[model samples]
Target: MIQETLGHLLPELELDPHTVSALLCASAAAVAALNWMQRRRIQKKMEEARRMRDLGLQCMEKAVQRFKQQNPGADPSRILSLPLVELAEKLKEGSLSAESVLYTYVDKALAVTRELNCLRHVIPECEGQLRDLQGQKEKGLLHGVPVSIKDHIGYKGHLSTCGFAPFLGPPEQENSVLVQVLKHQGAIPFAITNVPQSLFNYDCSNAIFGQTLNPWDHRKSPGGSSGGEGALIAAGGSILGFGSDLGGSIRLPSSFCGLCGLKPTVTGAIGPMAQDVGGLALCMRALLGDALFQLDPTVPPIPFNEKLFCASTPLRIGYYETDGYFLLPPCMRRAVRETGELLQEAGHTVSPAVPTSCSEAASLLSPAAAALQGCIVFMVAQDLVDPGLKPQVNCYRIPVLVKKILALLVRPLVSPSSGQLQVFYGSLPTLSPQAYRTEFIAKWKKLQLDVVLCPVLGPAFTLGYPGKLLAAVSSTMLYNVLDFPAGVVPVTTVTEADEEELLHYRGHYDDAWDRRLRKVRAVGLPVAVQCVALPWQEELCLRFMKEVETLACERKKCT
Candidate 1:
């Protein structure tokens, strides 16, 4: 077959065999040289990454080591051991010195950065921030609190690298609005954390920062793009951390690390964009009043409504295990189910609830996947992407002819519903995400539930496994698709019983990805459930999260 095809093509070219052979040889040589250049480029970036990381280590170590030597009696680890709410109280009472609190967290952050590679940079200006707070009788709400910033959010005089190498040159000229607000609240930005390259993948590896490992078990990935924050908080390196979530970035990391995270359905049309913002940022805007709305006039003039947040009425809770896209593992399903039962026991109504239909959404994933890949390629060169992400870039480069071929090959093997992915992937997706959100909102309103509970990326993926487990994010992604406010709370940890149950697990799907779920053996890792409410219902979302957290504490006590 090969000889016949070549025979026809060679004749059409009207070239001698020798000439054709030489042309092929030259093309191969050119390919090899390009490969070498790519390798060299990656090597150079890796060296730069290590050098920058080492410098951050030096700065962190010097401050932390100095604090340890000066005040030997001061418990360096105690600040991290306390809760964020408690940490704020101590600072408010003037019982804890801001300098010492910053020093303690910096000490832990340095250690965590060494072990988990979770920081982009340790805020070098923390000393100046502490000095300014001294002797102030009226400190802000977060007074003396150490907050870890995601790599993408801007801080004055610091680089917002967002895991891109070319984007790593100069420091930012101004603080992002969120940073300004946090500063107003007396919060100190102590350190910046690592993220996946382009802040796209769930896995935390990137050419610039390498990989941010799960603090509990170094073998697994801490869920990302806010992964570094998650890793830091889980390791007791920071009290409160901030991150962004286009999909499930904050929720996934929090769930993976056994922490709390919120993703508000707050619209940028009504929110401040001067800084990278998320759920809590909206709350800040709400609390700070209309002045913030004036600062960013594009934002909705909505302030934090204390009445909505403090309302303690029981919620009608909806829960589900699968979105009919990615079937979760036994452990994750159990976590959601257990949370539903717990919420019911606490006087909230809980029942099985389906999300705004997956049929339309499933068709959107392929286009969504392509667009996600397209954005990366458009912003970065092939060599600049982490080696792990490069393959994805190539796969999404599906040409029209290639897409047709792939559709033909794949359609026969998968379910009729999943086949829509081929059609969506081959075509261009809507540029503005708001169009789809409009449709999802209509369906969600009909469900009439105040809160919903689901898994956060299926029991924290094994290291390097999240990119392959994209569908597992469907449960969380649906909220992003609907622009709903969502919160993640550590409900339980994966137990020996959970691991045993997984060994015999048979999920709703029987495909390659489902088998991977069955094979995962994540014993002793934290498992969390996501709590969600409709758009502009962030106050209700947090309220349920607090209730869920209370129930989690009770479950821990009884166990």
Candidate 2:
């Protein structure tokens, strides 16, 4: 009788409650099965990582415990102190062999690994890699350079787990295109670094390889995705490293770790097709230029334009103190303002500039949507992500109707800036990438600016805090949204004074970011400024970055 009545009603109403209930139940069961499989996969992957980590620890401990004599002529300190360019020059001149350089870095890396937990996979094949370079007649472009790779990038026979549990199994059969290019240029990638689970969050902690701490302060994260590279470089374990940046991954970590990182703008001129390319092709396009498309015919055949890098005269510099969304803390704003002043003092024309639609882009990239969906999808399809992200994932999964009801029923009784409402609104995202870029470029060119100075998402905050400040990413995410070349230069360290200024911050909005700013106490952390240039202007970007670095370096030395 119920079936007959339902059939008649379904034909009449275009829907049946019983059929809808049945479909929902089936969908729920399928999702549950997916979740179960994912959990099992993660457990296995976790065990694999744990065993490897233990092995790495034991090897490192044994090396330290044994009285191993240092190379009679190798001064690890002098070797470590030379700039990468000078070291490459020395290697080319035959003063340094690739082997010695490799060992020095390996030893340095092992020592620091115990403290930071930055490396996810230490290449046990280091000896094999060194051997291949032994008899080369001419030193390659990166001869003797020891490079660290982000874990997500592939290398032959190494699993690029990407910090996802179900992503385990099958080590890659071939090197990522970028890795191949680096090797062809004589760079030896000796280690793969850690990343946050899902590579979405800023904190460099994951359930697979554990947390990577800031070398400057244990209380803080090293910044993430490319976070391990940041920590390793900051700890002096590697002279150079490669990392991917979506928004601020490379630049933020570089800022927090007090190192220089270049995020070359994706231009059509000369780079192996970059935008939307993932895994190895992106890195190759970034460092080697688009000339490598011969190796990858799928790549956009653009070559790196060498001429655009030159700034023949002083640049017209544009500077901004905030992203018009999250107002920066005093230290972060000071870094940008000071850098602008220094450029002006050096005879560059400095003026105010802003990205008109960046905030709208940031809204589109709201973490509540991207991060929550990523975590949930990863949670349901593969292994669940980190426990730290559980709260966010759970909240995002709440039905939109439920959220609206909560806003109506619960918001009036709670604080206006409640997390629930903010999350709900932010989860409703909208993006127009191509349109935003077109508008941004037109506005930027009208300003006639060679480079723009800004902050790297405020100063590195305490660990566990950045995830909460996802909205604060407008400062860095704007450039990413624009796909302009950008770099980070550390300008100052936090002083006791900077921490107290938050209590009295009177610049802009007095919202939750302000409240969180007031509670932050991350003194001694490095403050960094980001230098940005229009697409394909990496050379100019690097030069401006150098100017900031030189000024900052000289000032610190004098003090």
Candidate 3:
């Protein structure tokens, strides 16, 4: 019976018995050869990576030891105490040399990078750059300043993989606009930091460089896709760093890591010397100049006004704690409230405002935009993801088919709840082009609050929980949809009393989300809030943020 069955199935198998045996043998040999080749390649790559990592680590260790040896009485607290602006001033007046400043920061940054996995590549070339800049007669504002950039921002002749391994050999022939600007201003690009695989998610995890942890708390996340920049800056590794934001990439990381970041109004700060993709260039032009400038060059150029940063009066501030979809985590809620109170105390008019359903708008806009763009996001993700996560990648690649099969098979047994269904459904929409585009456009239009203040997410949850609160990202994505400038300010830490308040809370929206909230409450996380300004109103946003920071300082002093 077995022989007869095999004979019947043999025709469908498309090989004669002898041929199949021979083919199998050949395939086995081929697979063995391929495996050997792969093993050799992996071993070579690992050896190179190890050498680079070890060299960086050893150099940093020596630098730190030498610094301490030279200045035995130097205050260790100086590492964490001084802000970058003051450090820059000190470096300018001959009080600090380029060597001393760079050594100190490089030492600190390298140490932090080792601890947090924040760096993709550290440039030994920076030491030379610093020495050369110091010898120059004319020094720019950022002269001798050490700055780290996000990996996505290209640096000439340096590896610009943007966290993908395939692009890891050397720098680009031309620098990105921001990089060129930084170099022109005497900012040394010493290192490039890690990013999310697709530069989309808030969690800073990639297979190439791994995860970057929060400097304040190791087990928690530092925001992403500019997360490494946030961690490095906060850890006192770099006096100043450059980060790009689309959604809450820059602001979220800055907030999580307790550092200040500025996301300039679209094109208000762009320079012409660097290369930019058309969409970004267009976006920048739209925000900085006239929309008609796209068609006609005869339009007057609208340069970035320096006066915007030095505005005398505080502007009207609009604030909210939650945006209906998800409640603010205590830390984020406190940050927003404290910021609002501070602005009010500082004599800025503060008004409570509720933002409309921006998440719904984002949900609507994603489908249509994704469809129109021909699923570029998916393709980018596929290209960047590590082979180790191939299964996860496949789910995203064929989301509709895979999700339906998953829903029919796995979901029923594993996640029978409606909430789980919603979560599952969220992943499936990426597969539908028209659905993604329609959702994206509608979502964009729906989030129309004029300078809204909201939470970046719930309170600072631990590292592994970012996916759980993915929906909460709607707060940040709303501004991304509107192309507005949003800034995050750290307000306060979670207190025992805050935990107590949460203990008795009942589920308001749904039992599942409420349970997630309660789990978050148990963590005792820090709180921060986002203050968003209309496009090109970054100055106003910063002014409001300063007021909020002041209030937070006062509250701390009182406590």
Candidate 4:
């Protein structure tokens, strides 16, 4: 059949067999050349990445040697264990030199990166920063403290490679406003951490820099786009670090790593993560200072409000165990319950809070929404998309009618009430963005709540599940759309009882995502609850987080 059809077409075109063969040969060679060129380009990027990694490691070695010679028989572990505020106080009081703190963290950061593949590029200029700080008459708040930043945050003469090959171009000419604020406050920006490709997935892995593993367990994910910051800080590589969150990027990783983190009410918001809540407060105080306001005039000219943060007055706090959109795991529900009970014991009015009946808020604010909004342009013309992000991109490229049909077909197979169906069903706008935001804000006002307590998400899933479990983030996503300040505080660890609960787990809808989530070996993982406040109430949010941290610590001692 093929010969007869070709034979007739060839004769009608009046082309000989040799002509057809030649055309086919030319097409094959063209394809081969394109493939060769693409391979060379990626090779060049990898070479540069290695060069940067090696240079940072070499700088680390020199600093560590110098530190040992300067302070003979000093225990690095002792310094490593100190919280951010204590470390800063030591530096200011002259008991610990700025050089000693810098060198100690640099050494630990190197070890953490070696074990977890977290650091994207270590800033060798931290030594210069120390020298400059020493010459100053009045030291700033974060005096001589070493800090790690997300890979996408800008620094002078460094590539802000957001884990994409094509982003490997000329370095940024100057530090971003946030970085400038850190430096002015005497904080040394020492390292940049890894992120998922295009900052698209909650799980951190990209083709260029590879994957970043959890410090608690190598098999599980740390969470992204701030996964590296979470992993590094959890391993005690840095006392304080900064990461941006669009949708649970900062909160999820922080919860997974058993660290405290915040997501402010700003788009592409940059906030701090630390092992203790005090560290977060210090970082927030520094970021909201006069320096930040001057560098970025668009930012509110509000300095850190000490009165609001330190007020002992009780707050009317609302709590929720589930969002009704996605099923909450038993451990997650327990985290919220325990947090509420702790708050009540401390004299706060804690009550249940329910959101309006619209569940599409998270779907509209998710990474998939960013893809449909044209944020993934850098992903085009690449060698390949990471497996975690490929599904969202394909969903974006699918035809509208086809998506509707696919959504219908996927419903029964995944779950009758699975939140994953939103990806396909969201092909058309469901609600006005403004209307959704107003409804949630109205609920908050009606309840007269100063803050809300809820689960950050089911404790970190196994690596590579972030792409599949987008709906699980609904508990955290509502605040993102409302532009409210939200934070995560580690309240408990996954218990033997929690693990037992998982064996009998069937979600509200018995969803496929829940079944897959229950299979994650998270027996010993940390479980945390999210704390949220109204817009511009970051300090209040941090205050609530600190209260949770204090209660959890006391509870642990009693246990």
Candidate 5:
């Protein structure tokens, strides 16, 4: 096609065949030369990253060895096993030295990342921070706790690459406000974990830092952009870490990794991830302290509400087994079912409360909301020039009429479980925002619900599934659109029964997506449910999560 076009156009321009051939050859040669130079530059950057990573690993190893030599009989396993609150207590009471705890976690983090490829850089300044912290008379809420942070959250003298090659450059001169607040709380930031390129994708892989694998099953993704923090913490590398979430970045990873995570209503809010709800609560309390607000005035100065978090009054709870759009896997539905039953058993007034379809709500609430997804993909494509995101990029690049026609062509091939038609229908909003919000809030007021329970996603999806199944994120996207404070709690693990049930699964729409979701090899992976509350009620969200965590534990014991 190119040759034919050039042949006709060249004749019109009065160009000869020989001259055209010469020009084409020269252009090809220049392109090849540029490609070679670009490849060479990429290689150099990759090598520098490798060297930095190696040096960081070596420093961590030497620090671990030094600690072992100093505390010959120390039981690092015991220290590593302690929950965040317990560990903090131990450190504050002097029962466990801060150095000993730091080294123990560092040693474990080294092992975890080697297997999972989660960590990007180990903070070498931790030892110095420890020394300074010990000299202080006051012990903060997180005194001496070793914490991990997601890749984009800045630390001094370290590159905040966000898994993109071009971002590999001079290290940050000063710590970001989040890191400074952590340090002020006496927490040591030991490492910065990996992220998907540009912090946009749900899968935790990129051109520069490679991929982060699930700790539960390497065949599956750990979930992103907080995937590294989830994998590392789930593997017992770090007890407490911070991950930012706008959609389900924090909660999805936590659900996949069998950890607890929270996402606040604040835009681009950074939240806590840990093995238990208590850890998240503790971290949330510290993050909401005066230190954070004072350090960054943009933060709402609302201190953590102890009364809301500590209240034992039974909540009027709303629960749903599935969102209207996606066909949730059997395990996901089971998690919601069992969690609601447990919450009911615990005396919370659990009632059926299925809100409007997420896509519908998004259309009514924000007409150009779907464009945000496209915009994010475009930014990632621009930043990385990486091929992993090319499929999504290409989809967005196509004309809208073409996309609609393609969707129509594939409608017959899709199963009913995919709800493809509903998705399109939802895109065309019929109700006003006031009408929709009023109706939803009426259900809320009628139920007098304190929190709502739902599924986070289908399950810990198989590796490479997220990129193909972007629509599945609609389950969590609704809460994000509404700016609700949401949290995830592990209710149970996928059982043999759940896998058997999947064989007969027919999603809400019996399309390729539903079939693919059914085919995911997810037996034995952890299943979790989302807990959501009104905007700025993060403490209440955490409190509801804590209650669910307690009930889940008791149910496990009884089983």
Candidate 6:
């Protein structure tokens, strides 16, 4: 009977009958072994994660306690507004010393890092740099100012892990172009901030540095891949920091953290060094132009212009509250409205502006760009890589047929809407290339408006949730598609009343969007507004951002 049963199943098996039976038994044993190995790997990873989290927490706690101990009666908010630029000016004028300014910011930065997990390294050599700068004949604009850099941006002799384990410890070389520029400007390189693994996800969490909490609300995310810079800047830990944005890396975090950020048009600001991969230096020099050269030499030689930003009169402002894909959260809506009112009141001609079709533009642009580059995939792969299981290597090593079969069998278990898969499929030749070209040209022409204001995402969702709904990122990426400059400014905080209002929201968009927006309302998250400008419009972007900032400030006064 057993032989008959085996014979009947033989056609269904891949190997010879005897071999198939032995292999089946062995496979069971192997699966058991694999499961055991997976559990062990998971356990180890969890422990490591826990340890890193705890270390970060403890450090923050101690630093905060120290700050309180030092300034028993001081208001934390007062410390938050201590302007680095002003402090540097004072230091240059001989009214303040570099040592005092460095100490104040260093002490405050230490407190912030402990509380927010915003820092990866704090330089003890900050004092040495300050002392060296004190003797300089001509103090630059940032002289004696302490500045922090995101971990991914290189600093000489510092670790440029970009928050990955393989690149941990100190790097062999000195400053990247940006770092060199900052040093040339007389800024003291005091610390390096944390970043998400691979700098992909919006939430600033990783295996190396763990998660960075929002200074405004610890439960909420600070935003990423430049989240650490945002958090540190928001908390007044740094006056200026370097951040890069492919999607919304700079803008999202800045908006979420209630700080100002600029995402220059490609080649606007400089110095992401050419990285050597597999003994080949991948040079991005062709992509570098005037836009990036203004910031660093590692970038092309673009000169900074102060005149383009100086508007002689009130400017024409184009604004929109929602992107049409996702409804703006109440706080964000209010911010846009308030900004319009302020711009109008400030003598600017504020008008309602609508792009032709945000949905079509986003759908056409993002998936193709994201997938072809594997930009977000490698960014998060390090965090997802199982230390013990060797999942990445195993996936690579498996036979193609076996891999396809396994994927087919297992895909049902995973969510169809996962961004990882979406990004993966985005690399395929399935998208109509002509459609992309036509849409890109159309979107570019439609974006002739001076600057656009829109929501970062519908409502203020938590950190982890944004990963799945990355398509909503089109609000920001719409500009990246057009190679435009964009900025993010914090407008308002979520309240119970807003939640009550969102509870009744029934939008005309898809059910997935409705669900995501509803989930966002459940959490009292901060609302942020985004401003977009045409290509090579960093000056205009900053000006529009300042206008919004003024409006936000006025609203605060009114309240």
Give each model's whole-structure lDDT.
Answer: 0.73, 0.70, 0.61, 0.83, 0.82, 0.61
Worst 10 residues of 6 by lDDT: 274-283
lDDT of 6 by residue, 1-559 (tens): 6555777777666555677678779999998998777656655755664475456445544654675587576544543355544555575687665655565677677778879989877765665686688678976656776777777777766667665554554564866766666666677878788887666566787666678888877877788778788788777787667678877787777767766677767722321110011000001211233423665445336444456555656777777876665565566677688777877887877778766455544545534554433543454333344231132233334444554465466556545432222322231232353565466446545644566777775343465666555555667766665666777776667778877777776643435555666666434555667877766656667667666766776787889
Report the candidate with higher TM-score, 1 versus 4: 4
The clash number for model 6 is: 9
> What TM-scores do the predictions have?
0.87, 0.83, 0.77, 0.94, 0.92, 0.74
lDDT tens digits by residue: candidate 1, 1-559: 5445566787978876667677878999999999888768766866776687688779778878888888888976676666666667788898888888988888888888889988888888888888888856677767877787888788887778767776767879998877777776778888888889888788788877788899888988888778888898788888777788877888888878887787766521112111111234333533355545655665566667668777888888888887766677777788888888888888888888776555445445556656676777876664476765665566656664787677677767767655234443463334236667776666556767788888767466778787665556677666766678887877777889888887876655566667777878778888878888877777777778778777888889998
Give the C-alpha lDDT of model 4.
0.83
Candidate 5 worst ten-residue window by lDDT: 418-427
Query: Which residue runs of candidate 3 sit more than 4 Å off their true CA positions?
Result: 1-6, 9-43, 60-80, 267-307, 312-314, 368-395, 401-450, 501-517, 521-525
Weakest 10 consecutive residues of candidate 2 by summed lDDT: 268-277
Model 6 stretches astray by more than 4 angstroms? 1-80, 169-172, 267-302, 364-448, 522-525
The parts of candidate 4 lying over 4 Å away from their true place are 1-13, 366-380, 387-397, 405-419, 427-429
lDDT of 3 by residue, 1-559 (tens): 5445556778877766667667768999999998777656654654575477668767767866887799776654573455555555666676766666667777788878889888877777786686678567876656666778887777777666555544556658887766655655566778788876666567787666678888878878887768888788777777666677766677777767766555655522221111111211222332343433443354335643436544666566667777765565555666677677776777767787665444444554445434523343454433444432343344355555555675566445533223233343442332243444355445434653335566776454567566455555667766665556666766777788778767765433444555666765434445667776766565556555555666777888998
- CA error at residue 462 for candidate 6, angstroms: 2.3
Model 5, residue 389: distance off in Å is 3.0
Writing each residue's lDDT as its tens digit, candidate 5 over 1-559 gives: 6666677887877876667878999999999998788777876897889788989899889989988998899998899778888998888889999988898999999999999999988999998998898689998889999999999998889998877677788989999998998888899999999988767667898777788999988988999889999999999999998898866899889988999999888756888899999998888888888888888887789999999999999898888887777768889988888888988888889989978656565455334545765665555543545454555565556656665676566657655434455454333466776566666767777878888999888467776778777667777777776668899999889889999999998877666677778788687889999999987898899999999999999988998
Q: What is the alpha-carbon lDDT of model 1 when measured against the actual structure?
A: 0.73
Q: RMSD of each candidate?
A: 4.6, 7.0, 7.1, 2.5, 3.0, 8.3
Tens-place lDDT per residue, model 2, 369-388, is 55556455656445655765
